[model samples]
Target: MKTYHIRFYENRWIYYCISLAVVLVGLICNVIFGTRLDIQFTGGAVLSYSYSGEIETQKVERAVESSLGRDASVSVNKNVRSAESGQVSNNVTISLAGTNSITPADQTAVLKALNKAYPNEKFESLKMDSVNPSMGQSFFLKCIVAVLIAFLLLNLYIAARFRKIGGMAAGFFAIFALLHDVAMVYFTFIIFRMPLDDNFIAVVLTILGYSLNDTIVIYDRIRENRRLMGPKTPYRVLVNTSINQTFTRSINTAICTFLAIATVFVVGSVYQLNSVV
Candidate 1:
C-alpha cells in the first residue's frame, strides 16, 4: 500500500500565521462596526405584527423609536405564508434590544404610532414576547457553564481512556482545537454584525461536540498505531503515520457535514421564511 507521509509539525508556523491573520482582521472589523447582543441575550421585547400592503421598514422603525424613545430594528417581509396555505401576509417584526423590558404602556403606544403613521396599512399585532433583563443574563451564564462543564468532562474522559498514549496531551490539544473553532465562529458572527443570541450558544455547543468527536477518532487511530508500532517509535512519526491513515476518513466525514449544512442553507434561502409567522 502506498501511504502518504507529511510533516504537519514542520509547517505549524504557517497555520499559526494564518490563524493570527484571522484574529487581526476580526479586531479591525470590531473597531469599525462593533458587536451587538440579541434581545434573547440582552433582554427586551420582540413584537411581530402583520401589516396590510406595502410599507417601508424605515417608517416602522421611526414610528417605534418615537413611541419608545429608544432605537428599534424593524424587518419587513412580504408574501409570507405556509407552504400548505395559499393565504399570504406582509409582516413587520420589531426588535427592541436593551437591558430593560418593554412595558405594556409602551407596547400600546408603539402600536398606535404605527397605525397613525400608516392608516391605510391597518397594522395589527400578531404576538408580543419579552425577556426579563435579569433572566437573560442568567440564561447567558448558564450557557457558559454548560460549555465549561462539557470541556471538563470531555478532558477527563479522554485522559482516562487514552492514558496509554499520552492521554493528557491528547485531551489538551483537543480542547485547544475546540477553542480555536469557537473563536472562529465568534469572530465570524462579529464580522458579519450578527447578534450573539441563543443561536450562537447552540452553534458553539454543537461545534464542540462535533470537533471533539473528530479529534477522538484520530486519537483512537494514534492509540492503535502506537501499540502496533511499539512504544519505541518517535512521537512525531507516530502521529504523522496515524494521521495519514485517518486522512481519508476525516475528509469524507467533513464532506458529508458540508453537504448537510449546504442543504439546510439552500432550503432556508428558497423558502424565504414563509413558515415563520
Candidate 2:
C-alpha cells in the first residue's frame, strides 16, 4: 500500500478556517431559511385523508395554501393499506405546523378546496390531530436534556477509562469532536429545510454513539502509543504518530457508514418515505 505523510498539526489553522467558513455559511442559510420544526417540536395540525384515486401532491399543496392562506406540507403515500375485499387505498397527510391549532372552519374549508380541486379522488378524512405548542416546547427541551445527559455520561465514562494520561483532557476533546458532528447535522437540516422531528433525535443519538466509538478507538491507540513511545516523547510527536497509525481505520469506518446510510436513504426514497429520506 502507498502511504503519504501529512502534517496535520502544521495545517491545523487551515482546518479551523474551513470549519469556521462552514459555520458562517450554515448560519447564513439558516437566516435565509428558518428552522422547520416538526409537529413533535412545534404545535401543529395533521389531517390524514384517504383517497380512492390518484391525487397529485402539488395539487393538494396548492389547494391547502389557497384555502388556508398559509403554508403546509402534503405527503402522499401510495398503496398504504389493503382492504380484505381487495381494494387498495392511498393516504395523503396534510400537515400545518404552526403555533396554533387548525380551526374546524379552516379544516372544513381545506376539505372543500381539496374536493373542488380533485372531485374524482373521493378524499375521505381519516383523522385530524392537533399538537399543543407549549407541550411540544417542553418535549423539545426534554430531548435536548436527554442528549446533554448522554454526553455527560459518556464523558464520565471516557474520563474513568483513560484516567492514567489526563483522562479529563481526552474526554473533553472527544466531546468536542462529538459537538462538531452534531453541529454538522443541525446545520444540514437548516440548510436543506428539513423539519426537526423524531428522525433528528434518532440521527443525533446514532451519531453520538458512532462518533464516540471512533473517538474511543483513536484515544485507545494514543494511550497504547504513549506507553510504547516512552514518557520523554514530545506531545506533538505522540499525537501525530497515533493519528497517523489510525488514519486508515478511521477512513474505512467513515466510508462504510456513508455507504450504509446511502443505502437506507435510497430505500426510503423508493418507498416514498420522505421522513426517512
Candidate 3:
C-alpha cells in the first residue's frame, strides 16, 4: 500500500498550542465543575439493595433524599441472577455516596435509616470506604507519584535498550507522547463530566502500555533504517519513512485492541457492571 505521512514536529508550534488549549480547558473544567468521583476515592458508603418487585429509581432517590435530607446518588446494578432460570434476575442496586461520620453509631444510624425506609428489600453493605480529608489528599498525591515513577523507569529501560539509536532523547519523546495520551484521557473525562474513579487509573495504565508498544515498534524500524540506509539520510526523513512503513501495523493493532475493549465496555455498561466491576 502507498503510505501517507504527516510531519508531527515540522509545525511543532501547532501541536504545542493544541496541547496547551487541551490542558487549560481540562483544568478549568476540573476546577469549576469537577469530575464526578465514585465511592472509592472519596470515602463513602455504597448501599446495594435488591427489591423483589420493580421500583422506580427516582422514587428511591426521592426517598433517600427526604430521609437523609441530602441528595444521594441512586443507580441500578442488574447483575443478580435467578437460581431457577440460570439467568440474570431483575434486581436494582442503589448506591448512596456520602462521608460517613467518624463514630460507629453515626454510621449505623445511616444504615438503619436506609433499612427503615425499605424493610422488604435485601440490603448488603458490601464495603465501607472512608478516608479522612487529609488522607484523601495524600492518596491523590501518591497516585501522581506512582505515575511519574512508572514513566521514569520505563524511559530508562527504553533508553538503555535503544542506545544505538538516539538514546535517551528518542526515549524521552516517546515518553512525552505517552504523557500526551494520559493527559488527553484526563481532559476528556473532565470535559465530558465523566467520573474519574479507579477505572480511570486502569485506563491510563493501559494506554501507557499501548503507547510504549507502538513507540518501540517505530523506534526499531528507525534503528534498522539508520543501519542499512546509513547516517547520510536525514533523521527527519528516516523518522517519517519509518512511521509510514509501520503505520499500518500500528493502526491495525490499535484498532483491534480498541474494538475488543469497546465490546467489553458495551457489554459491561448494558448488563454486567456489578459482576464485572
Candidate 4:
C-alpha cells in the first residue's frame, strides 16, 4: 500500500499522543484506586467444594457469609459439573479474607449453614489454598526489577541501532508503545473485574516483546531509507514511507502470532486451564 493509502490523517503523531494519554490515565487510576488483588496477593483462604441439590447462587453466598461471620466471596465453577436434566450441579469456590487454619468446627459450621439453606443439599470439602501479602510483595518486587532491566536493555539496543531520529526519543517512544499495550491489558482486566495475578505480568511481558519487535522493524527501515533515499526527506514522510514498505510483513507476522495465542486462550478458557489464563 502507498503511504497515503495507509495514512489515516495528516498527523500520525496524534495517534501516538492519544495512546500515551490513555495509558497515563490508566496509570493514574492504578495509582489512586490501586490494583484489584487476587486471593494470593491478599491474606485469604480459597475453599473448593462441590454441592449437589437444588440451590441458588445467592443462597450459597449467604451460607458462606454466615459461616465465616464476615463478607466472603463465592464463585461458581460451571466447568466442573454437568447439569444433567432436572439435576442441579455446581462447584462452589469460596474465598475468605483471613488465611487461618480451617478448623473442623469451621467446616461443620459452613456445612450446617449450607444445609439450613438447602435441606437436601450436601457439601463435600475438597481442598484449600492460602497465601500472604508478604509473598505477593516479594513476587511483585522481582517482576518490577525484571521489567526495569528489560527496559534498560531495550533502550541501549535501540540507541545503538538507530543513531538517527534522536536515539533517545525513538527508544522512549518504543517504550511508550509497550506501556500502551500493557495499560490496555490492565484496563481490560479491571473492566472485567478479573483477578490480577501472574497472568497479567505475562501479558505485560508479551506486549513488551511485541512492541519492541515493531519498533525495531520500523526503525530499521527508516535507517535504510535515510541511507539510500537520502536524509533530505522530512521525518514524517520518512516514517510513513517506511511503515508502508513494511506494513505487509509486520501485519502478517502479528496476525499469525495472534492467531496462535488466540487459539491457546480459547482452548484454555474452554477447558478451564488456569495456567494459560
Candidate 5:
C-alpha cells in the first residue's frame, strides 16, 4: 500500500480567505435584498383553499389585492394523485401581512372576489390561520435564547473534554465554524428568497448539531494521535494527520445523510407537501 501525505494545514490561510469571501458576499446580499420572513415569524394571516380547476396565480393575487386594498403573496400548487384515477386538485395559499387576526368580513370579501374572477370554478376554503405580531416576536426571542444556550453548553463541553489539548481554543474555533455555517444558510435563504420561519430555525439548529459532532470527532482523533505521537510531534503535523485519517469517514457520512435528505425533499416537492419541502 502506498501512502500520500496532504498538507492541509500548510495552506490554511487559503481556506480562511475563501470562507471570509463567502461570508462577506452573503452579508452584502442580505443588506441589499433584506430578509424574507414568513407569516409564522412576521405575524400574518394565511388562507388556503382547494379548487378542482385550473386557476392563474396572478389572477388570484390580483383578486385578493383588489378585495383587501393591499398586496398579498399568493402561491398555487397542483397535486395529481394518479393518472388512471384522474384525480387532480389545486391548492391556493394567500398570505397577507400587518394583521394578527383575520376577520370574517375579510374572508368573505376575499371569497367574493375569487368567485367573481372564477365564476365557473368552486373554491373551498381549507383553512385560515393567523399569528399575533407580539406572539411571533416572542417566538423569535425564544428561538434565539435556545440557540445561545445550546452554543454555550457545547462550548463548555468541548472545553472540558479537550482540556489537555488546548480544548478552549478548539471550542472557540468550532463555534466560529458553526457560526460561519449559519451565516451561509442565512445568506442562501436571502438569495433564494426563502422565508425565515420555524423551518429556518430548525435547519440552523440541525446544522449546528451536525457540524459540532463532526468537529468533536476530528478533535478526538487529534487528541488520540497526539498521545501516540508524543509531545514532540509538531502541531500542524498532528492536526493534519488526524484530519486525513478521518476524512474518508466524514465524506461518506455526509454523502449518505445528504442523499437521504435530498430524497425527502424531492418527494415532498413532487407531492406538493409544503411543510415537508
Candidate 6:
C-alpha cells in the first residue's frame, strides 16, 4: 500500500473558511425564509379524505384552498387493493393541514368543493383530527430537554474517556461540530418549509449520534498516538498523524452511508412516497 502524508494543521485555515461559508449561507436562508412549524408542533387539524378514482393533487389543493380561504400543506397517497373477484381498486387519500379545528361547516364546505371538482368520484371522509397548541408546546419542550441531556451525557463521557489528551477541548469541539450540524438541518427545514414535527426531532438526534460516534473514534486515536509518541511529540504532528491514519475509515463509512440513503431516496421518488422522499 502507498502511504501519503497529509498536513491537516497546515491547511486548517482552508477548512475553516469552507465551514464558515456554509454556516453563513445557512443562516442567511433561515433569515429569509423563517421557521415553519407543522401541526404537530403548533397544534392544528388534519383532514383526510379517501376517493375511489384518480385525482390530481393540484386540483385537491385548489379545492381545499378555495373552501378554507387559505393556503395549506397538502399530500396525497394511493393504495391498491384486490377484491375476491380479482378486480383491483385504487384508493386515493388527500390530507390537508389547518391551523385550527375543522368544524362541521368547514368540512361541509370542503366536501362541497371536492364534489364539484370530481363529480364522478365517490369521496369518503376518513377522519378529521385536531391537536391542541398546549400539548404541542409540551412536546416541543420535552424534545429540547432530551437533546440537552444527551449532549451533556456525551460531553461527560468523552471527557472521562479521553482525559489524557486535552479531553475538555476534545469534548467541546465535538459538541460544537454537532451543534453546527443541527443548525444546518434547521436551516434546511426553514429553506424547504418543512414542518417542525417529530420527524425533525428524529433527524437531529440521528445526526448528533452519527457525528459524535465519528468524533469519538478520532479522539480515541489521538489519545493512543499521544501515549505512544511520548510527551516530546508536537501537538500538531500528533493530531495530523492521527487524523490521517483514520481518514480512509471515515471516508469509506461516509460513502457507504450515502449510498444507502440514495437508494432509499430513489425508491421513494419512484413510488411517490412523500414521507419517505
Predicted model with the maximum TM-score: 2
- Model 3 residue 221 lDDT? 91
Clashing pairs in 3: none
Instruction: Give the distance in Å from residue 260's predicted Cα in candidate 3 to where it truly belongs.
Output: 1.5
Give RMSD to native, each candidate. 4.1, 3.0, 5.0, 4.8, 4.2, 3.5
lDDT of 5 at 104: 91
Per-residue lDDT of model 2, residues 137-189, tens digit only: 78668878987897798789889998876788878888899999899889888
Between candidates 2 and 5, the one scoring higher on TM-score is: 2
Residue-level lDDT tens digits of model 1 in 39-67:
76667788988888888888889998998
lDDT of 2 at 154: 76
Worst 10 residues of 4 by lDDT: 1-10
C-alpha displacement of 39 in model 2, angstroms?
1.1
Judging by lDDT, tell me the better candidate of 2 and 4: 2
- Candidate 6 vs. true structure, TM-score: 0.81
TM-score of each: 0.78, 0.84, 0.72, 0.76, 0.81, 0.81
Tens-digit lDDT track for model 6 on 43-153? 667777767778887888888888888666666666634455554444444444455567899888888888899988877676677766777778778878988898888
Residue 254 local lDDT, model 4? 85
lDDT of each: 0.83, 0.83, 0.72, 0.75, 0.83, 0.77
Candidate with the larger TM-score of 3 and 4: 4
Better of 3 and 4 by lDDT: 4
Instruction: State residue 71's C-alpha deviation in candidate 2, in Å.
Output: 2.2
